[model samples]
Target: MATEKWVFMVTAQTPTNIAVIKYWGKRDEVRILPVNDSISVTLDPDHLCTVTTVAVSPAFDRDRMWLNGKEISLSGSRYQNCLREIRGRAGDVEDMEKGIKIRKKDWEKLNLHIASHNNFPTAAGLASSAAGFACLVFSLAKLMNVDEDPSHLSAIARQGSGSACRSLFGGFVKWTMGSKEDGSDSVAVQLADEKHWDDLVIIIAVVSSRQKETSSTSGMRESVETSLLLQHRAKEVVPKRILQMEEAIKNRDFASFTQLTCTDSNQFHAVCLDTSPPIFYMNDTSHRIISLVEKWNRSEGTPQVKF
Candidate 1:
């Protein structure tokens, strides 16, 4: 390592995603593999997104991170997994003007400083971790010049947070629950571009901005362990829904899309409640909104508006 006090940094912005076909449980928790294939639509980066900046410097003693300007521990396995995967693929980087050169071998020893912030609320069932982790890995890959495609990088992001793999793409994306032990085949694939269905509108209601009492990871674990609905949904329900959802998106079939999205969402919440001791992700206000949407749909004789 050089004695020069040179700092190299990279910043990236990644948007969160709304899972139409929800991913509620993990088959392999260690690798962050979901039990069922899920589909999501990435949101606009102009709002409700995460921006992360990663820096590498010889002066730093170890890998450290700050989330929303507050220092956070990187001791978690999720962070370690992402760091290990990206570092292993680090490439040589050189900047002539800065008189700095970092070989691929130096990445193992070089400490990184990461700072991330989310425009939307964190852990309020908003998939903030998805955007956060995707931004983290995406920014780091740019910093280290890791030679990998978005699909490959999505696999690394999946280890950080399951839904994060979907944020790697723009529009509609599918996270296939690969039939592999190592999770190499479990990757996010783009179903369509952002402009694929430009006419559709998405309305987000923020009933609560505070973090939920139960984390998604813990809730999923609890559900997988106890909820019979989760097992059935993962094995029977989700597979069919995923296929229908894909066709809906492809054909821009609003009726089918609305039906699939709303039902899958309801089923997901039901699975949450089916867990031992139960988990409630939606409050009264959320229920009211859903009820109102349902009433309007029932009166209109079709899904004129979907929640």
Candidate 2:
């Protein structure tokens, strides 16, 4: 191949998101489509984010990836799906300085080497997969010159992680659980920019950095199968809460925001408890923190912080 010695690369950083209205159950597991709309706040990338570098070379023999300096397999369906979706949208690229040209059709034949690093700890309930997948899609899109906008690319990211779609944008984002079967319309949209509610300070207290025993995916599946509350929350509670949360975010109503956030979080855990095995995500420390926050809010006659 003429480009044997040439390597083309792109680097991107994406911030993690905290779901105020959590996405607990999935309607379509293969596509990672949620049963209801969920809203989240994208944290500042400087503090919590993932940095990914994607490189394509004709000299490489196969697609490979490394996470946090350790080599990892790209054989998983999530990785394969993201890669296929991105490559399908790739456009022609010509770098005059490097004397390298990659045609749109050539993307399928090329192999990629991806290295990703997260600023925060993984599996610590930190949404590392959200930032990691968002970064992977964003960086690959840049390298391959994908013409899609952020919202369009978010659909691709959604296949990697349900919450990942929200990380594509800054500030408040909502993942619309579109009615489409293909999930083409299920994408993330910005509710409000970062500056709109910049005054709301966020403080994260890490009670335990240990990985949770239950993953959100498996836990959600269990909830869907065993918990009747999951159905009620997804069908009735979430729709109303989503509308209220959207309004709160739009109007910058901290009181309403805090109320809705706390209520939704409580319901999410309630469903967890309703599960057959009863998944316990929050430890004693977590409960104490929630109690303290609730007491403080009551004493102040308004929400001072959201748990």
Candidate 3:
């Protein structure tokens, strides 16, 4: 066994993303595969993100984690799945200076200690999990010396959070919902880098920082089970909308992009309402804010701000 005194770790920061074409349901729940293709714009890491530190040591007996300085269980399938996938791809790591050497096969026997902190509120409908899980997978991959590309690592992150797949990229990203049962082909791809749409400004409205009563995972499951609209969306609406969104993004058509973004966001909430026992992710304040934006856009004949 290697010396228990030495600790080898890697730290990484990943940004949260906001979906333009929102992902509302899942076809494979255990894999966290989405029901439809969704596109998103990655946010600035300096503003909102998750910073994760993954440490490996011989002294540790088991995998453990802490979120926001609070110890959290790693027994959850999301965490376990990411760990398993990354470990499977683990490569031999050696550091002569630190006098540490880990063979590829040694990863399975080793334990990890992870500490993650998110700048934004978690589970408050701000897509914090997107950043949190992405950072978790990314930092661990670095520590394990996994040689996979970002797209490959994104597939692993998707198992942690569906939107997390998109966070692996810089600016515009699309998560393709693959038809395969194994979800091997389902992964996120970068559409455009941050410099592609440098003129665009993103502003997030803070309605409530409180935790949501219904988590996105549970709500998505409910919608998939009971909402016919969600099925229709997965089959019909999003496919065409995705193409349009792609064009709008490519052409830098601000008007078209804003239209698609606002439309998809509203329809996503509508799917929630269509579900049995209807989920209400937005509040009265949220509705009023949307209405105000619409009114202003109408008066100006162009979008000043898109919700």
Candidate 2 error regions (>4 Å): none
RMSD in Å for model 2: 1.1
Shift in Å, residue 152, candidate 2 = 1.1
Which digits, one per residue and each the tens of the lDDT, describe model 2 over residues 1-307?
Answer: 2545889899999999999999999989999999899999999999999999999998889999999999999999999999999999999999988889889999999999999999888988999999999999999999999999999999999999989999999999999999999999999999999999888877778889888999988999999999999998888888899899999898999888988888889998999999989999899999999899888888998677768
> Which residues of candidate 3, in runs, are more than 4 Å off?
none
Relative to the true structure, candidate 2 reaches a TM of: 0.98
CA-lDDT, candidates in order = 0.93, 0.93, 0.92
lDDT of 1 by residue, 146-190 (tens): 999999999999999999999999999999989999999999999
Candidate 3 to truth, TM: 0.98
Q: What is the Å distance of residue 33 in model 3 from its true position?
A: 1.6
What TM-score would each prediction reach against the true structure? 0.98, 0.98, 0.98
Any idea what lDDT model 2 has? 0.93
For candidate 1, the clash count comes to: 0
